[model samples]
Target: MEERVPVPPPHPAQDVTEHVGYRLKRAAAALRGAMDRALREHDLTVPQYSCLELLDEQPGLSNAALARGTFVTRQSANVVLRGLEDAGLIVRAAHAEHGRALPVHLTPAGRQRLHAARGAVYAIETRMIEAVPAERLPALLADLDTMAAALDA
Candidate 1:
C-alpha cells in the first residue's frame, strides 16, 4: 500500500488578505487613518482635505463633481462645502450659470492650507510607494485603477 500525502491549507493572505476586496478596503482604511492623523494638526478632516485637493487640481467643480471626486454623497459634500465656506477657505458662486450646480473654487487661504497639507500627504504616499518595487509603481497604479474601473462597470 502506498502512503498518501495531506494537502496543506492555503496561505491566509492569498485566501483572505490578498483578496481584491479585502486588500482594497484594508489599503483604504490605512490611508484614511494616516491622512486623518496628518490633517488633524491643520484642523482638516479627510473629506475636507480631499475637497481642497480636488479644487486645487480642478477649480470650479460643482457640488456633485466634488462629491464624486471625494467619494462622498452630494449631501455630505454640501456640508463640507458649508464648513469650508465658513472657514473662508473656498468660495462658491451664488448662482449656477447652468443650473443649481454652484462652481467651487479655493480661496488663497485654501491654497496655503493645501500647500501645507500636501507635504504631509505626500510623505505618506512616498512611504506606501516605496514599499513596492520602484519600477513597478506605474504598473501598480494602473492595476489599481483597472480594479476600480472594473467595479465601476
Candidate 2:
C-alpha cells in the first residue's frame, strides 16, 4: 500500500493586504493615528474635533445632521456633543421648527479650540500628502473622488 502523506492547507493565491480595501483600511488607521497625535495638544479626540469642525462650518446644525455629516449614529453624535458641552466647547439650542430636534452650536471657547487645532491638523495633513509628488496629487484626489462616488452609488 502507498504511504499517505498529509498536505498543509494552501495559502491564499493573493495577498489579502494588497487589496484596495485592506490598503485603504491600513492607510486610514495610520492617518487616524497621526490625527490623534496632532489633536492631543488640544485635548480633543477625533470625534470631538469632527464635531467642532462641523458645528463651526454650519452653525446651528441639528444633531441628526451632525450625525450624518460625521458618519456616526445619532446616539454616538449625542455622546460626543455631551462631552463637548461638558468641556464648555459647545451648546445645544432648541430647534425653531422641530420640537424634537436640537441644534448644536459651538461656543466661543469651542471656536478658539477649533482654531488652535486647525494648524496642527493642517500640518499633519501636509506631512501625509508630502509622501506623494505634488504633480500626482490631482490624480490621487481624482481617484479618491471616484472611489467616493462609487461608494455613494
Candidate 3:
C-alpha cells in the first residue's frame, strides 16, 4: 500500500487585529495621518496634493481622469479643482477643445506650491521605506500591488 501524506491546515488569524486587512488598514491610517500633518504646513490636503502630483506628470488631464488618478469621486474632484482654481493654483479651460471634457492645467503658482510640498511628502515616504530592509523594498511594493489586484479582480 502506498503511504498517504496529510494536508496542512490553512493559516488563520487568532483575532481580528491580527488579520492582514486590519494591518493594512492600520498602516494606511497612520500614513494618512502623517501626510495630513505634513501637508498642512504647505496648506494642502491629501486629495489636493494627489491631484497636483498627477497634473505635474500629465498636464491637461480632465476632471474624470484627475478623479480616477486621485482616488476621489467626480463630484469631490470638481470641488477640489474649484478650490485650486480659487486659490490660483490651477485653471480649467473655459471651453473644451474637444468634446465636453474641459482640460485642467497647473498655473505657475500651482507648480511652485507642488514643488514646495513635494519634499515633505517625499520625506514621509522615505521614512516609510526606511522602516523596511533595503533588500525587501521591491518585494514589499510587489506584494502591495498583488494585494490590490486581487481585490480589483
Candidate 4:
C-alpha cells in the first residue's frame, strides 16, 4: 500500500516584482553587473577578486574552501586559481602536505591588485548602503543575515 503525502494548496499569485525573492534576484543581478564593470577595469573577475580577498584574509585556503566561500563550483575555482597563477598573482604548493588539495596564497602582485580592486568594490557597496536610511542600515543588514540563515537552516 502506498501512502501519498498531502500537497499544500496554492496561495494567491502576485506580481514577481512585488515578491521578495524576485527583488533579491534583481538586486543581485544589478550588483553583479556593476561589480563586473568595476572589476573589468582592473582586469579581474568577481570570483577571482573574491578568491584573492579570501586568500588575503586566511592566507592558505584550499581551492574547495575558496569555491565554497565564493559560492562557486570547485572546477570554476580551480580555473580562477590557474588564471591567477598565470598572472603571477598567486601561488600554490607543489604538493599537498596532507591531502590532494593545494592551499592557495596571494603573491605580492595579488595584494597590490586587491588594494585597487577593494576601492572600486567599496565604492559600489557604499552606493548601495547610501540608498538605505542610515538609522535602518543595521536592522537591514541583520534582516538580510536572518533571511540567509533561514534558507541555510
Candidate 5:
C-alpha cells in the first residue's frame, strides 16, 4: 500500500469572530455579571431581584404578568414568589375578581430592600458604562432600540 498523505482542513475565508450573535452574547454575559454583583449584597439572585422589581413597579401584578415581564415560566415565577413571601419581602393576595388568580405585592420590607438595591444597581451601571464616553450612550441606547425593533418586526 502507498504511504498516506496527511491533509489539512481548509481555513474559512471570512472572520467569524465579530459575528452579531457572538457580540450580543458577550455583551449580555457582561451585563449579567454586573447585575449579579450589584444584587448580591441584598441576598437576591438575578431572577429574584427581577421579580421583586416587577412587583415593586406594579403593585398588584398577577403571577402570569410577572412571569411574562421577567421572561420566566409561570412555575418558576411561583417558586420565586414563594421564596419572596417566605423572606417577608412579598405578599400574595387573592384577586378581587379573578378567583383563580393571585396578585403579588411588595411588602414594606421588600420596598426598602428594593429601594436600596436600586441604588446599588445604578452605581453598578454607572461604573460599567463609565469607560465609554458620555456622548456615545445615546447612540448606543438608540442602536439597542433599533435592534429591538428589528427583532420585534
Candidate 6:
C-alpha cells in the first residue's frame, strides 16, 4: 500500500488575499470573466452555455439534473431552459413522461451553437492551463478535488 503524506496544519495568513479561499475565488472570477467575454460572441451567457453543453452531452436531462450539473438553482435552470426554448435551441417535452421531470434535449440549432461556442471555451482553458507547468497539472487537479471534497464533507 502507498503511504499517504500527512497534511500540514493550517497557518495564519497575513492578509485576506493570502487565504486559500480568496485565491480560489479570485481565480474563479477571472475564469468567469474570460468565459463571459468569449461566450458573448456566440450570444451565450455562461449559464446558458453550461446548460447547452450538459444537454449536448446527456440528452433528455431534467431541469433539476441540469441545475445540479450547471451549478444553478432549479428556478434558474427553468429560466435558462425557457430562454433556450424560446431561441429554438432546445426543446422540452410538453408533459413529463415520468414524474414531474420534463426532459430537455438540444435541437439541431443548439448542437450547432454549442459546437461553435466550444472552440472559444476550450481556447480559454488552454490559455489558463498553459500558465501552469505541464507536469504539475495532475497534482493541481487532484488538489482542487481534495479541497472541494473537504468543504462538502
For all candidates, the clash counts are 0, 0, 0, 0, 0, 0
Error of 4 at 87 (Å): 0.7
lDDT (Cα) of model 3:
0.94
Better of 3 and 4 by lDDT: 3
lDDT by residue (1-153, candidate 4, tens digit) is: 999996643444455576678789998999999999999999999999999999999998999999999999999999999999999999999999788988889999999999999999999999999999999999998999999999997
Per-residue accuracy of model 2 over 1-153 as CA lDDT, tens digit each: 999895643444366676777778999999899999989989998889998998888998888898898889999998989999999999997555566778788999999999999899889889989999999999999998999899898
How good is model 5 by TM-score?
Answer: 0.80
State the lDDT of candidate 3 residue by residue for 101-133, as single tens digits: 999999999999999999999999999989999
Computed on alpha carbons, the lDDT of every model, listed in order, comes to 0.92, 0.89, 0.94, 0.93, 0.83, 0.94
| Cα-based lDDT at residue 68, candidate 3 | 96
TM-score, per-candidate, Cα-based: 0.88, 0.85, 0.91, 0.90, 0.80, 0.92
Better of 1 and 2 by TM-score: 1
Report residue 37 deviation for candidate 1 (angstroms). Answer: 0.2
Whose lDDT is higher: candidate 2's or candidate 6's?
A: 6
Q: Which ten residues in a row have the lowest lDDT in candidate 1?
A: 6-15
Q: Model 1: what TM-score?
A: 0.88
lDDT of 6 by residue, 5-72 (tens): 96654667677788898899999999999999999999999999999999988999999999999999
Please identify model 4 stretches exceeding 4 Å from their true place: 1-14
Model 6: ten consecutive residues of lowest lDDT: 6-15
Q: Candidate 5's residue-wise lDDT over 59-110, tens digit each?
A: 8888889898988999998898888899999998855556677778899999
Better of 1 and 4 by TM-score: 4
